[model samples]
Each structure stands twice: as C-alpha cells, then as structure tokens.
Target chain A: MSEPIAGAPNGEPLSSDRPPAPSPEEAIRPDGRWLAQVEAASGVKAGACYGCKKCSNGCPLSFAMDLHPYQVVRYLQLGQMDKLEGSSTVWICASCQTCLTRCPNQVDLPRLMDWLKEELVRRGQAAPEEKVRLFHQLFLKGVAKRGRVFEGELMAGYMLKTGGAFGPEAIKNARLGLTMLKKGRMKLLPERNKDRRWLKALFREPKGGSHA
Target chain B: MPEVSYYPGCSLEATAKDYAESVEGVCEALDIELRELPDWNCCGASAAHSLDHRAALNLGARNLALAAQGPSPLVVPCALCYNRLASARHELLEGDDLVIDEIKALGGGYAGVEVVELNDYLSSPEVTALAKQRATDLDLSGLKAVCYYGCQGQRPPAVTGKADYENPQGLDRLLGALGVTVMDWPFKTDCCGASHSVPRPDLVFTLVAKLYKRALDQGANCIVTGCQMCQANLDMYQEEIAKQMGKQVYLPVLYFTEVMGLALGIDETPKWLKRHLVSPKGLLEKAQLPRQTWERL
Candidate 1:
C-alpha cells in the first residue's frame, strides 16, 4: 500500500522542518499589531480560530507542508512571522479552498495564504517551493504577453529556467507531451488577442509607470 | 433555440481541446446556441490571485466587461475559469469601486454579467428535459461513474453561490436522467491538486491516486468530471500512479459533456473520446455504446 501520509518524495519526514512549538509563556503574549495587520490586509480574523484543526484536517496538501493550515493561522495570531515566512506551508498551499470550506468559523485561509505569498514575493524572500512560485510567475508572464497562455512556450520556458529540460521529470513526461501533440491537444503556435493594449496597461507597474 | 454567451477559457484553445469540442457537440445537440464572447482574454487562473490580487480581479473584471456586452449569463466550461470569473464579478459588484474604476479607465464597466458553471447550467430543468427528450434511445447503463466535482467548480459558497456546495448533485442528477449509473461517492468535491501538476506532480499523483482507488472501491469503472484540469490530472497520471502503487488502478477519466454527447448519439463522440490520455473505449464498448477507434500516438 502507498504510504498513508504520502511522505515527501525525498524521504524527509514531513514534520522535520516544522518550527518548534512555542512555550506557554510565549503563547500568552499575543502580537496585537501583527494580528491587526494580517486581519486588515486579508480581511480574515485569525483570532477567531480556536484551534479546531478542521482546516488542517481537511487540507489535501497538508501532508507536504511544514506548518499545518491551522498552525499558519496560529502563527499569525502569535506574531510568529519568522516561522510563517520560512515555512513551506504558504508555497505548498494549492489554494484549493477545502480548508475555508470546512472551517466552522468560515475563516478564509486560502485568501490569507494568497496574501502571504504576495507579501513574501514583495519582501524578496525565497519560497521553499521555488518551482511552484516559478510556475505561477511564468504562467502570469504568458498571460500578460498574449492575453492567453501558450502551453508550448510556457512549458519550454519553465523547463529551461528550472534546468529541468533533461531531468527525470522531463523524460517521464516526454511521452505524455508527444501524445498531446499527436492528439492536437498541445498547440504549436500561440493564440493572440486582437486588442492587447488594455492587457498591457493592466500589467504595468502603477508607482513607476513601468512595464512588469 | 436558447442563446447564451460562452467563455471558453485559455485551456480550451489547446490542452482542453477535447473538452471544447465535446461541449460544442453537446450544446448543439441540445439546441443551445453559444455566442462566443469576442476577443475574450485569460482569467489569470491561480497565478494572478497568488501573485497580485488587483491584477486577478482586474483580469476577471475585464472578461466580465466583455461578457456583459453580449448575454445575460456567461457559460464557462472550465471550473477554474468559472471560479475566477464568478469570484471577480462578486468582488467587483460588492467589494469596492477600485476595480470598477480600473475597468472604466480601460473602456469598460462592471456590466454585472452573470456567470454560470456549465455543468450547473446544463443540469437545469429545461436543459435536462431537453436532454431526456433527445436521449430516448440512449442506454449508458454499462458505465458506472463517480462524478468528481474538483474544487472551484463549487466551493467557497460566498462566491459560486452553490446551494449544494458540500455535496453537489448537478452531475449526478444530469447523468441519472441520461441512464448512466452515477455512484454516490464522498470524493465529489475533492481537490485534484489544480495547477500543482506542473510544479508538484508527486502531490497530484498522490491525490489523484487516492481518488482513483476510492472510485474503484466504490465499484466505479470510470470518473466523470466537468473541469478540464481535473480530467487531465486524473487521466494523465493514472499510469504513473499505478506504477508507483504496484497495482492495477486503471480508471477512464472522462469529461461530462463527452458522456452526454455519446448518450445523445452525437457523431463527434468517438472523435472526442479518441483524444483522452486514458481511453474510455473499453467501458463504452462494454456498455454497447459506439465503438471508438484509437489513434496510435
């Protein structure tokens, strides 16, 4: 049978990278400013979570995360920004919304995770799951250019940028790619939108008036 | 003929061409005229929401503006696109005036175009009645399927506004009306690791493998889904998952429209089935549905 927990492929224990739990003394001192900032930015009340663990229990990708879903919220509540910033939980989150769906408190954890990812990018912090961030960036770059994603180009860019062109993953998927090409599922050329001026304006940086 | 605006998102142009074709075939058979939204762009998918909030909303708002130019309700096939467009519309109308102003500056406004997920729209009483009327000779009893409604098709009730978000019966009810045995499985609203297939195939493989195993345990021969990404992930990674688990976990993942088209006896059904990574030919043949000729890749 497959590992029930679906351990990390590298054989590293899922909890190995998790930060140690806080002592009772440390837990009592709530980070009021940090909580206020997170709540204000994400519009989610992190304080509402009474450690129900429903979000973590329902999270599909929690097995691969360093900090569980509830832990992310708890860390935010306690002003443990360093642990959250360094955790793989934010990057590993697929934003599937299962956590938010099952949360009795109706806390929008997915929205908070999205905010954390943007914040990390703004602060120039390296994501634990670099490829995930790279994929998102590359995907958006394709959208900004042609107003639609060109699968062939995007795949090529991702492979070359990540140096996974001839990696095991590439070799494994080569047949899948060939089959898609044969079935006309992978287009050879990119489709362009007729009017791209508005799309271009949307991608432009507001403060410096520079193109992204 | 009933008319509605169609937003075939970026995936339909390539990766999900089969879904696009099957959707068109099914819509045509049901006498539904789909008006293609002119010059429609991408919905920015998960990438935009993760990196830039404003951009995600703006991208969705722009599409809504174009969609508003044509019809009252925009029909979106891809669940991810449906979620993005629907969520964006929700934010634009209710959140604030920032996106409204941005769209206005771009020569558009929040026209408040209603966006509906295609499966939900098709399961409506009118469409179901039309399908039932057309499927008089159709017999899909040979196929037993678990309707997988991968996340985003219906979730975050505040956005999609699905009354049965937890246990959506849209696909089950639609397939039941067509004579297919739709199994009541608990994995209906499970996430298929959307977009993580690229960066984290292992994660997707794990999630999809569990889904395949559960479907099999439920005595299902195939899985039917409405989202292109879910269909692709579940179908494409089966062999890999099977190899990893050292077991026979072959389950044909199909688009709901393809099944509907087959039941309705649309000629293009075989053509659509030919494009799937894991062919559902055996199951169909067993059911006495039209035999499909496979294309050697």
Candidate 2:
C-alpha cells in the first residue's frame, strides 16, 4: 500500500494551504480484515477504485467533507478504519448518487458511506456531525413508532434532543413550521398506519425480526 | 381509463400536499386512475438505508409486496421514496436469498414488480397526448421554465435504469407539450441538499441559491420539478437563500403536476397554487391564464 502523508486526521492535508511531509510511523498500512468487512457488508469492492477523482469532482457535498469521496475510497483500500470512521464525509453525503453515477468502476461510494455510518453507530462512536446522525435516528424512531414519518413530531423531537428547542436555528424552524401549519402544509395530527403490529415487529431487534 | 398503483410517500400527505392534490387533478383530467397502494408504510427513505441496509430493504419490500399484489407498475411521486423502493427492488432482483428470505419472513412477497418514477410515468406519449388534448384552451406561452429534476429520480443509473440520467428530458418534454418554453439548462439533475434542510439548512440554502441563480441565468421565469422534497427545498428556502445571497432571488419553484393541472384547467389549480410558500400566482397572471379567485381556507 502507498503511504499517505499523515498530518490531518484522515491522512489527507487539512486544507490546500498546508501540505504535510510524509512520516513513516504515521502512514496508514493496509489491513485486509476491515477491507473484507466493508466489502462483505456493502457488497461493493473498494479495491476496484483506480484512484480516479471523479467521485470527488462530482460530489455536491465534497466541499464540506474533511476527506473527498475518492479519498474515502482510498482509505477503504488501505483499510484505514480510523480515517473512514472519523470522516464527516460519511455524515455529509446526502446519498445524492453523483459519485456512484460518474464512477468508472461503479464503486458505490454512497453505499460504502452508509455502511461506514452503520458501523460507526454499531461501534458506539459519535459522528463528527452529531446533528446529522441525530436527525436520522429521530427520523427512524418516528418511523418505528408510526410506520410513517410525522414531520411535526420529528422536528420537535429533534429540537429537544439537540438542546436547541429555543435556540436561534430552532426559532427559525419554528417560524417556518408556523407558516407551514397556517398554509395547511403541516399536519397537526400524525397519521397512523393500519398495521401497527407488523410495524412493531419490524422495529423489534433481531433474531427473527427485519433487523436480523 | 388506464389504471396504475400510486405511492404518495409521507411527504405528499403533509409538506407537499399541493403536489398530491395536483397529481390527483392532473391524473383525473388525463383519464388515468391512480389506485393508491393499500396501507402503505414509509419507505424509510435515506434514514433507513443509511442506518440499516436490511431494515431499509424490508421497509421498501413491504411496500413493494403490497403494490405487487395489485399492479404491475407502482408509480411513486416522491423521488426519495422512489429511489428507496426502486433500490430495494434492485436488491431483490439481484437474487440475494438472505434479503429475499427476510422480506418473505416479514410477509413481503417478491414478485419482481416494477417501480416507476412519477415523472417518467407522466412523460409517456399517451399521457402527454392526453395532457395536450386537455390543455387546448390554456395559454402557457408566457411561462419559461427550467425543469429541475433533483438527484433521486435519475442518478446512479444502474439502480434507476435511466439511460439518460445525466440529461433527463422528461420534464422538458412534458412542459413543452403544455406550450411552456422549457429552457435547456445543466443544473436539471443536481442535488438540492434534500433532508439536510433540517440538520444543515446552511448547506441547503447554498445549493438552493445556486439552483435559483442558475435558473435566472438561463432566462427561465420559474423552476419546475416532480419530487416533493425538491419542490419543498427549492420553494420553501428561496427567502432564506435570498437573504444569504443578499439579492432578490424570488423564483417560483413548482411541481410539474401542478403545472399540468393548471394547463388542464383543473378547478383545484388555484388552491394548489395558494399552498406554495413562494406563490406562482403572479407568474400565472402575467401569462394571461384565467385566474379563479380563491379565498384561503
């Protein structure tokens, strides 16, 4: 495996302004076990990426990412779990499928990012962008309860969980929420799905459930 | 009447209710019967797939299983829901026995049912012809639109099977048939930072601002789309985007179905238009389209 100059947390330069020199001790070494796990979980071979930066070039959210999309694939190829798990890229990726669409190898980077997020939660690691992960969790929790999303409830839960119930952002959202409510765009009541039993069973943890 | 199963997804019921009403009106006028899928659950969208691959598949499969019982093609209006359901179908068709078994265990049968995006379904020759016939008296000549087909509908060509995912022309063709000058622009299939609007409004504002500015640059009066999320993001955030850009960027972002309904002279067209955060009423008035006086309910 080629050594990446390890200065930034993900072994990529912190920014274009500062380029770090290579250090042998800090270089990421390829570990096949993690790579195998990612491939097994995502069903996409990250090793197939030929260092083309097409994924990075096309990603809409790459500008906000610590590591570009191609760099994430490179980390996977090197089995750099710390870099992959630590990335804001995984959280920031909107699953827009831009990278996967332009990828010559059909690398499925978005799917890989999804696996990394699940693995991060599985390992009990806090996502770099805590709110992004929180939003997904709250969204799923609503789905589990009602079998459908209650946007009004979801937003309230999110605000409370993030401790931003009366914060500036929350205030902005609350105003928008009021407008939506007035316009009849927001439902005051949550709609219930008929088969709540099936939904409960589906949300229940493993063993014969859908999660397994 | 040609009948097909419909999946409105969760957004259509609330935030994009306008899209739902417009879709019904347009379909009714076109003589198409939309049989809403029975007891449909959420497709889990990006959240399900992002958190648990199996759960996402199961959620989508459950809906597909229900749709499979009635129709060959399940038409989904929300692009996010469409992507999740179609991705689940793709995985099921890939012959993953584990996934298939889990879906079967969840009482979801895999019958290889087709999941069609609503825009592609509406763009069919028959539907477009019907729309043209219904729109004979409508004058949309003053409306110039840039059809913004946000990412979910046509990306990752492998899953969507859209050969022209990069330069999809379905909305352009449909709008053109309605006599609206569909401006050809490059940002049609771009991402509008969907769902991130909640967690990261800054990102959505930036992306949406770019889309709005590009629409203006292309000489389009408005932006047209099919997905509810796209419409919501593009429509609801224009004020925020304008504030951030420090410019007057008030472009009317519309759902294609609403436009279709307007062309068909559907009575509920004014009601649907009233629901928009950025109203298209002024644009319609400028186009000399007959305006029905509507009092806010």
Candidate 3:
C-alpha cells in the first residue's frame, strides 16, 4: 500500500490549505472528469444524485458509516476520491441495495460502493473496515476453489484471518457452530463442481477487458 | 402441471437442510414437480457481487445456461441465490453491450429462461388453489406468525422484480391461504444482517434483536421467513438475543415451506420442524395445528 500523503485519508490530497478541513458539504468542488469516471466505472449517474438523502435515511448501517449514502454520492459528485477512500462508508456497505430501491434518481449506491471497493483494493490501500473486506475476499476465494461454500471451511478461514481463532470470540462462535452441527445444519464436507476450470476462469480478468 | 427447475444453492444442502426438506414436502403436496438443476454451483451471492462483479455474474449466468437447457421456470429457494441468478440475467439484458458479449461467451447465452423465486411460484393462483385443497385436512389458523422477507427477496427491482418490493405479500398470502394468521409488522422486508451472522455477530445480534422485539410486540407466536440466511440468523440467535434482552424470549423462526408443509399434512412434519435451533413443536402444539402422525414425541 502507498504511504499516506499529508492531509489525505488514503492518498490524494485536498486542493485547499489543510488545517481543520471543511465539512463535506462546504468542500464540494465540481470535477467533471471525476463525475464521468465514477459514472463510467459504476454505471451509475453520479450527476443525478441531486442531494436527496433518501438513500441515507433508508440505509440500515448509515449510523455506523463515516459518510452516509448521500455523502458518498456528494464525494462522487465532486470527484473526491480521497474523501471516499478515507471514509468507511464504502468499505462498510453491506450491499443490501436498500439505497438502490429508494433512490428517486435511480442511483445505484450499492453498485457505486462495489466500484469504490474495487478501486481501494486496486490501489492496495488499507480498507477503512478490515473484517468486511477480508470476509468478501475469503467468500469469493472459497467459491472459486470449491463450487460451493462450506460454512465450516468459510468460518475457519475467516476466524484464522481475523484473529478469531484461539480468541474468545472463536469459542463463542464454536458454541454456535456446535449447536448448528447437532441440528445437522452444517456439513463437514464441501461439495465441489465436476469441472471447476470454467468457474475458476471467471474470476480472472479477461485480456484488455474492464471488469466494471 | 409444469415441472419447475429447482436450484437449492449451497446453503440448502447444509445449513438449510430443513428448508430443503420442507420445501420438497410442500412442493409435492402442491403437485409442483421440481427438477433439481443438474450439478448447480454457488450463486456467489452476499459476497461475490461485492468483490468481483464479473465473476459473480458469470457464476449466476452459468446456472442460467444450465437451466436453459431444460424446460422449466428456474425455481430458486434461497433468497440470495434468487437474487444472484435473477440479477445476472437482468444485468446481461440491461448492462453494457461489451460486458454482455463477454458474459454470453463465458457462461453461454441463455434465452427465455425465467428465474422465479420459490415464494412466488408457490403463491401463484393455481398453486394456491392446490395448496388450499391439500391443506383442507390440516389446521393452522390458530397459529399467529410474522413473515420476514429480508433483503434479496425484494430489493433492486431489476433483479427480484417482485411486484411489491416495499411490502411483499406473496409469503403473506401463501401462509394466509394455509390458515396462518400473518401479522401486520413493519419490519417485514428489512435486512437481517445476512452474512454478518458471521464475522460480526455483534451487528447481527442488534439487527436481529429489533426483529425479535417487533415480532413479540405484535404478539406473534413464531416468525416465518423465505430466505435460508434470514431463517438461520433469527432461529439460531434467539438464545443470544434473549441474553441481550435480559429476558427469556422464545420465537421459532421457520421457513415458509415448513409452515406450508405442516398445513399440507406432509408425511414428515417432525423431520423439518424438529431441526430448528428454536423448536416450534411447543408453538405448534399450543396452536392446535394438526399433528396427525408424529404425536408420539
């Protein structure tokens, strides 16, 4: 990951003089190119946001987010990638699409969040919220290897990565795991696809092709 | 008399075994012939879309391709699986042409293969008639339950295409048809902190607490949901929720099919109902819902 630059959350610095950065509302400066880039990447019209806070209001996790859904759009409207990178809103998004359903402008905030996540990972920047990102990676990796997700395998892998293994949390989770097992809810073995080659190939980016 | 193609997804085989069993029982009673999708893979839902959009689409697309080879409306039971499969098809028809071309090449182009959620399939008029006829023998009107539709069932209309995304009535009407007194609750279509059931149990605990509180407030005896992940979270975490609430609270979270299976007078009611972490037997017994066969317990 790149070293944190002065006055920048992830890397890009604010244009104005630094100390006591203005609130996002006052910091809005139109960058047409950023708007275009965001629209291109997310396939969402960032320009159409119109500052409606419906997405923010309906979001279940907005309280935990550093920037609410509307604010994320505001950052995209101003092409403020640095602000988004620094904010936990994108990384913390559950991708529930509650925002997408409520948007009057049909702005797909979930898709936008997905695009932002991809951007952050591409830059090798540390995610604002670590566990969620790690979980998403492990989830995909598990699917890529096996045709399906074995809860036992996924849980073990997640606990190991997040330091839950041998931790107090692991014990608590183990109790629940045992309960599920007794109920015959968890399978000890994973089911694999007959030919995983095609499935594996899907994860790789095609030559000269853009993912989003 | 159409034979629907069934996609159980990964969860149905393991964590959602009861859901699978109950669904089969309900399907059989309703005379809805289900042909399991041969060697179906994961939908990559609740994870893949958030990570690799292309891979997620391809994963869902591959299943669509496989199902297209058959003649049936692809019936998906898991809400997340329904979302992924339907979303991929939606995106392919609506997304960028270049990406659509790539998906077609990778997963093979699928034409006229309609992906349907199991809830909608069961709730359709003809099936409802069959269900009502089949359920004539079983008594369930005494049971008051709240229906939870958690995210994938109704969000991002492009994918789910549910008529009433904000307030889904399919499960309600289906359960109601079987004489279940479906409660009028506000949190019906709310999210249940899905995958957060793991990794971040704290959030899930809080989220699920709200659901439990709401159901109790409405005097619901049990909670019925269509999604397996929702069922797991609500059903498995009651003990934790009780601790969090500082009171003894018991709410049996059941799949819609389980309730339907009970009302349909299926062969094995105990098989599926007994599998829940929170047993619904007490609730079932109290409600006076018929247990024609498995009363020996």
- By TM-score, the best candidate is 2
- Local accuracy of candidate 3 as per-residue lDDT tens digits, A31-148: 7688888788778887898887999999887767889989889878887788888788886677778999989999888988888887787777788777887888888888878778
Write model 1 residue lDDT over A1-212, tens digit each, in one string: 33435556877445545688988865656666899898998778888999999999989899999899999999899887888878999888988888888898998999999999988888778889999999999999899899998989988898888877787967866777898999879999999889888776778766733222
* DockQ-better candidate, 1 vs 3: 1
Instruction: Show where candidate 3 strays beyond 4 Å.
Output: A1-30, A205-212, B95-107, B290-297
lDDT order of candidates, top first:
1, 2, 3
Clashing pairs in 3: none
| Of 1 and 3, the candidate ranking higher by lDDT | 1
Please list the C-alpha lDDT of all candidates, in the order they appear.
0.86, 0.85, 0.81
CA shift of B191, model 3, Å = 0.8
What does candidate 3's lDDT look like per residue over B1-297, in tens digits?
A: 678889999999999999999988888776678999887889987678876777777787778888887767999999889988888888767643434443465455554579888888888888887888877566677678999988887888867777789888888898888889989899988888888767677778888898898899999989988999999889887897889888778898988888877776676868887778888877877888556533632
Q: What digit string (tens of lDDT, one per residue) describes model 1 on residues B1-297?
A: 889999999999898999999999999999899999888889999999999898898888888888778876899999999999988888877654557454666555454788999999999988988998898586788789999988998878988888899899989999999999989999998888988999888899888888888999999999999999998899877887899977897688889998898778787777888888887767776767644422221
State the DockQ, from 0 to 1, for candidate 3.
Answer: 0.46
* Docking quality band of candidate 3, CAPRI definitions: acceptable
Judge the docking of candidate 1 as incorrect, acceptable, medium or high: medium
Clashing pairs in 2: none
Give candidate 3's error at residue B148 in angstroms. Answer: 1.0
lDDT of 2 at A212: 19
